[model samples]
Target: MTEPKIAIALYSYEPQEEGELLLLEGDILTVLEEDASGWWSGESNGKTGLFPGSYVEYVDEQLIESLGLEQFEEISEESNNTTEQDLTQQQGGEFSGQNINDENYVSDEENEKDNTSQNQNQQEIIQTQNFTRNIGGTTMIHDGFIWEEKEPVFKVTIGKTVKRKKLRGMKKYTAYLIHSGNFCVTRRYKHFLWLRQRLVERYENVPVPPMPEKQFQGRFGEDFISRRREGLNRFLNRICEHPILRSSQIFHHFLEADEYQDWKMGKRAAEKQNKKEVPFFKSITCAQEVTKDCDDEITEFKKNITSLDKCLKNVENVATDLYLSNYQDLSASYLKFSKAFLKLGSEAKGIVGKNLDIEGKELKERGKEQRKIFIDPLKDYNRLIQVFIETIKVRDQANFQYVSTHAKYTKQNMGELSGQNRDKLLLKQDKSDRMTNITLAEIELFHYNRLRDSKEILTNHLKTQIEYYRKSSERWKKVKEEVEKIPVIHGSKKLEGMEDLSEPELFDEKIETDTEENQTSNQIDKEIEKNDEDNEEEDDEDTDDEDTDEDDDDDQTEETEEIEKEKDENEKNEKEKDEKENNDDFEKI
Candidate 1:
């Protein structure tokens, strides 16, 4: 048999003339023919040219297939199994590592046991033993992303369990009520963790929403439980929203299974069937509207996801900071403010102190509004973004397989055109095409859903912000008005000159300088406006007599003695004394 002409370049070569092939080290070539001269004519990188015979080393074409297949097989094997903890893929929150797919697999001893009566299943399995039959392939995709729903949404009516009774009255564990749509089942955190694990393992083509990170120490706390419950709800919401996942047997089993034994059987069945490779994708095809070449679409989708994730992540971070700084401790901080004000108001013994109490209560209400209207949804949105990214990553895995198989077929196609090789090539081509189709479908579905979700989440987020700000502004405005109603002498205790604040200081040289200073909490006297006209009449007289130094000084001395006689009563009686003292004390507090 004539060996197939193949050579590996031993040295780099730059083409010096037209029709001469360029050669780099290790460059493979097809040895078309050789002339009697030292120069050898060959095809390299699609160019037919002659090169120095010494620059190339020939190898048997048959070895290439064997070697290439070994490397590709290793890649395929590695992809099937990965050791790194994919924190984002499985139980998103802190969860003990558990393999849902393997844990659910039927064991030898269990298989021998009668499963029919012991299933204790809440819902009946398909009589035909195929759940997909009812699920139908048509519903799994909308423009190619699986499970685009048009009929009715798969909803988790209650995601968070407000109460968890101890399992079997055992203090060691608590069973949370996990409800999906009409089904309600008691499940532990581990069960949810495993569900996510199985999903990540089984659907290399689907992104499993990550659970919230585990809360180790505070897991039992009400706040932690509430947050985790909400997070779990969001996770389930994503699962239900996914067209492919909505009818998942394993997920349904989790939601509807009654006894522990039945849950095990359902888990086993779900996993055993997981060995079947993307059975749901068998009926799916790339739609006509999608681009013919999936590589371009994938590239475009990837770029778009990168930009979108970056933008969303940044927004999520900003919201997180806002929540933490402003609303997380909002209740505690505001209540503390209320305490200080109430204490100061008691000391002031005037309307100013009463108004301070109102201000404090309004602060508390402002914090409450922010947390209710804006904080929760923003947090939910942040978690959703992470889930969306993990889902997008599923396509990367599928793309890898497609690229690997395509490479194998392309290399093998370059080999000897034997009957057996031709058949293998056809199979490889079909597989590559199938992967391409699925990837394209997912890209379309992902893009559409992302846009839809973003619009929905964004609209809700903005509306909440508007509501939160609106309530806060109106509350504070009310506070400002009440603050201004405080009597001048009783408004603030330590504002030395505020009590003497003239209603009309327009003719005074110091008027401009004192204007801003007089307009603070110290000026909360309701009587100021009523005195404006009365005081304005004295403005012209005061300005005209400014240069009568000796007479004005003698008159001031007589008035000072009278003021001194009343100083003791006025000193503690002025609201400025209490207001100033309150401001200083609150700052320290």
Candidate 2:
């Protein structure tokens, strides 16, 4: 075995058998078998690894001589046409294989002749392969490079043939292989070829749409290239350094030097920008203006919300206070009513007992006149009952008025607040809905109960007062009956008393007279009839006059009140209208 030559093939040298003869072909070298029938090994500096003689051929001097005369003759012609200065310039580097085929056994004369003929033959071959034409034709290219037409297209063929005998016994072999499929070399090669084909198709012979006159008008039609040239350079230099184009080393080098830094700086700046918090995007055209308007509206809405909060608080306070006041008044009236009822019960009991006693009382007729002594204060009892009923009516009316007025104002305020606060709740629909949930009826109920409670308290009170009046009348009647039971003498002249009265009888007579002096007493027989007729006439006349005046006055007062209310409302509306007109004019400006 021979060691591969280190000279010339240093880029592809490899060890071989120590005794093998390594032959040379220019900078290429090969190891030969002992018989020298063919080369066993060879190397080239520009290629990977060593090559076997089966795949490589040597260009020795003998082989060069055998190349024939034409190719050499063509080279000689081209070389001769050039000046000596040009030859010197072209031949500045070493040409190492000038004597490669100079055989040691051949005569110098024959060698010279052989060299000359060989050179001529070489020239013809060179010339034959080097013809140039002035022909013009377009050659559509693939990937804009690589003249693929001259090379045989790579292909592999498959025929419908199989190792039937071997596969026959392995029934599931195909299925097994399919199930175990992976990205082995075969699959990878197929995928790589598919991707390559796609890439090639993408870059090949693309068409451009024709530009319309409208699109290419003015400077664009003729000077498009000139005008765009600077932009094109800037794009190539500045923008090409972006990651989309920078992946390829070949492309990366195409960018101008300064543009590389500019692109990097731009990316850094973009990243810095991206790091900042971004606002949510909306589709509004005047987004900034809309946002400002929204902010202003929001500020105003917040102020309104504050005002509403205050109003709600006030409502709560007022409602609570009104309820409490109504409750307190009702409670106070209830206490008063209770006391009056108790007193009335006592009086009624006393009156009933006294009436029974008075019905059993004795009356005496003396002298020529019928003088009656009676018991019971019936007139006082009737008057007290009347007073109690009148007081009750006054109390009930006052309570009803207070409750009605309160309910009216609360309901009106709720309506006005809902209307006036509409602007504040424009964006807050849920809040508005909640506000609408408040009811006029609920406030009405509260006021209604206040009146009911007050009425109940007063009714109870009136009942008690009536009872007390009855009781008082009963007690007075009892006292009157006891007084009338005492014996009395009407004669003042000692008459038929039978002798001079004793000291005791005398004192008794004095007491009887004094008691009679204190009473309007038994003389009411005449006075009662006369007074009854006169009182009846006066009462009828007074009642008729009162009824007529009350009806007339009530109608007149209602008409006056209605007229005044209308006037007030009209004035308020006019003032509001003026304010609104002024606001509208200011807004126009």
Candidate 3:
């Protein structure tokens, strides 16, 4: 009698017995006999032995027939004139027999063709299964390329604040995903964080982009919420750009999940599947050693993070303690000064003093505001630095463990270990290699996130500080103008004691001015002598250009003559005016 065939659908953890068929997951076996004890004898890979019937699942012949029929139908549909039999014949004789439920089958020649077609189809299916699995409606094509009719896009908008019972009435930042407008999903920053973490864990080779850091202060602030929403949109766009990462299940779920709980459940199931141990032989690439050079580079990165952390901490300390304390002290001194001005009462007080008091109070408030602004941002930056340092430390530990495990396995496999022992070693090596790659990717991600987050925080902090100081300066400038307008008060002088000067005092002032003019004339003569010496030096330097020098000297002599004539005319006019003024004064006397 012809025996039925079965395939192992899932892995069996049971130990193999002597004279028993050891069925690996996905192994095809031809069933021979079934016993009442739920044991079935089967032939697999040319060996005949008994195995548990529960350990294997029967292959669906009807399903294969249906698939073959669908192929034939597609061919027939493409060609209007093609008959069903003709399409079937063209499909390598896959549907040569009667219907699957029929009592009579095809002839031996057709059966032979059908067997050949089935074998070919099975081979093709096995070869393509690993690389071409349809994940989240995304078709993975050859060479790990994901093919889609329309590339998915995220049109993210910050929606109204959501209040959930689980969130304890605290408003949550809600992001609405109008995914190409075909479907929509509502997610929070936390959901996105969860998706990102899963993607990083599952896809070791793919480079996942960084997400925006969580803002504690402005958790529900409008601008912060809008920024985070846009950031998430950009992040999704980046994921779509990568072929492998785009087809990832978590990414798909993030875009398509209608309910948060459903997405969570799906994520959990996917994570569980991801944890399944893949066969060592299936992952041959893992046997390859991660080079020592990578370890050295990671070590260097760790050192850089350590240095950066120290520098950031110092900056944070300065912002909080040193600079903040200085501002506070200045504010207190201003307050004291304002109090002293108030104590002077009406004697020293004016509108200017009141304005100064107001300014001092404003300055104190500003100092406190600045302290909060500077210290709060620095605290955020310090936290990011700490996270970066910790990530690197964890990565280093993982790397060390992986390298040690890999080296030990490599030694054991290379030595006098048996076949099974070598297999075990190789498996251990593969696991270690995977761990190393995971940790390495994490380190890279941490580094990227650190740079992204720190840059943003520092930039915003500086902008805020600049804006604060600019406004403060404008306010202080108005106060300074008010202070400048205050008139100076003289202690002893009275307005009634002042009087106009007499003629003798006015004449003495004129005589003093004449003596000062004579002294100025003596100084001008000395300056002219210095100039003449400088001209002589210039003449010595320009001895070869005697014609040009002669022309310059002639010009200088003409200008000097003109200046002397003008000076004589001015002296004559001044003497005439002085004589007229003296005659008028004599007539008045």
Candidate 4:
């Protein structure tokens, strides 16, 4: 098992493991004691306990050497001031020890033999006290300065006092220089571990040494140290240049708006926990996630809706009228339209997935492309129709001008003819008197000829104009018909009725009545003809009876008596027949 790199402060320290716990931001602590398990020895309050080795990272040997040298220098500086009483006090009680506070520390008269030395030492102590009490209007301390708010950090055993610079801007400024104010300066600390992690992230395939002690010596040298310092400086620069910090604190509200909003939202959510419905725009991106404008999502949804509408309209336009009338394959078409709508809606939803309000190139390009493909066509079609209508109007105006000019010219030239011709022209011009005059026919003849020629020219021009107008009108009519049939995407009727008429059965009653009347009239005419034929048949039968009566009398016997009576009747019938025949012959002749 790897040894712990730093010492950990426990209630007790014992010998169970070999590891070190970090202290003072960059201090490496060695395990004084260890056992078979993964526990390391650490000391606190004169008691030792087995601490876990895994809790510590081993420091490099070179760092330990440098620290020892620094320790030596500090030991020399305090050699004169070191007291057995001070040591005793540190070992006793709760051991509130780090740098000795004046409240708990003093010197014996024997130890203060040099009065000048004593004065210099007292002055130095006073100066150190003042510096530690306040640094740039903020409480700061040197090494081992323990405070209730701050953790105990081991001070440098020996170092020159750093000059206090203004640091500009604010009277009270706390520089975030040290990683942890209370921790020891050690090679194998969490801060160093973070630095190592950053290095690994930046440079792939970085060779890490198995033994942190050896590895630290090899890698974290002057160059790495320089890079780390540079990185730290850059981080500080970013904080200094931060908009909130650079500008007036009046803008602090805006900087804290997000946090304030989140807190407010959280309170609202807690208050209304029982209410299931969330208000629109209430649900927001969490603080950890980036937020974006809601308008983008709305626009994207609109585009998708438009696209689906277009697909539906195109399907309608392309579909055959006969097929639409009978509605064949309607199920498939409906499914297709539904699928398209759903897919487009899904795409629109995803367009702002996660960070819906964030701006990016992909979103911009998507919006642009959607407008071009879906919006431009309808606009172009509308513009073309408008232009077509205007063109037709212009053509009509031109035709009107040509007709008016021709009429005016025809009227004006007829007035230039000679007197007799002029008189004749005047007669012809008058609709009421054109045929009345044949006087001075020669002048009239010339004028009439000219008028005829002019009339022919005018007629031809009018005919051509009329034909052109008809063609243009027909063209426009067809176009308008097509456009009307084309489905209007939004707010248009879903199911269109037949173009022929809304109700085809409206004329059914009239048609039925007409059919019935025609049938009745034909039947009556046939009946009348049949009646005439029946009358003629009756007349023929009477004539035949009369002829038979003359031949049957004597041949009848008793039956002949009956026949003879019949023959008497027949004789009368035959006389009537002969009279009728004579009348028919006369009529024929």
Candidate with maximal TM-score? 1
The residue-by-residue lDDT of candidate 4 on 1-589, one tens digit each, is 4453333221111232334322111122456656555555754224444455433334334533654645422332343223222332322112223222233235556644644464454334323322211011121211221111232222211111122226483332112233222322222223333333432232112111111112344243443333334333333232223211112111122123234465355434433321222111111111111112222332343354446456645643543232222232232232223222222222222222112212222222333333333333333333323332333333234334433443454467643333223222222222111111111111222234335534754565466546645764665565566546644467755443212223453222122234433343233334334433433433557667886886575456568578779999999999999999999999999
lDDT of every predicted structure (CA atoms): 0.53, 0.31, 0.51, 0.32
Q: Tens digits of per-residue lDDT for model 1 on 328-362?
A: 34433333333233223323323344444344445
Best by lDDT: 1
Off by over 4 Å in 1: 1-151, 159-171, 259-261, 276-278, 289-292, 326-418, 463-589
Candidate 2: regions farther than 4 A off: 1-429, 439-441, 490-589
- For residues 1-589, write the lDDT of model 2, one tens digit per residue: 6654322111111224453332221133434331233234443323333332322222334334664334433443332322111211211112211221122224468755655664565444433431221111112122211121322222121112112224566531100000111211111112223322322232111111111111234432223322222222222322122211222222222222124465455434433332221110100011011112322333453354346445545654553444333333333333323222222223332333334323212100110011001001111122223332333333234334433443454466543222212212211221111111111111222234335534754565466546655765776676687656645667646432122333434212112223331121112222323333433443557777897899999999999999999999999999999999999999999
Candidate 1 has its poorest 10 consecutive residues by lDDT at: 83-92
TM-score of each: 0.51, 0.14, 0.44, 0.14
| Model 3 stretches with alpha carbons more than 4 Å out | 1-127, 130-289, 322-418, 441-453, 486-589
RMSD of 4: 47.9
lDDT of 3 by residue, 141-177 (tens): 2211112223553344344545344466564445554
| Model 1 C-alpha lDDT versus the unseen true structure | 0.53
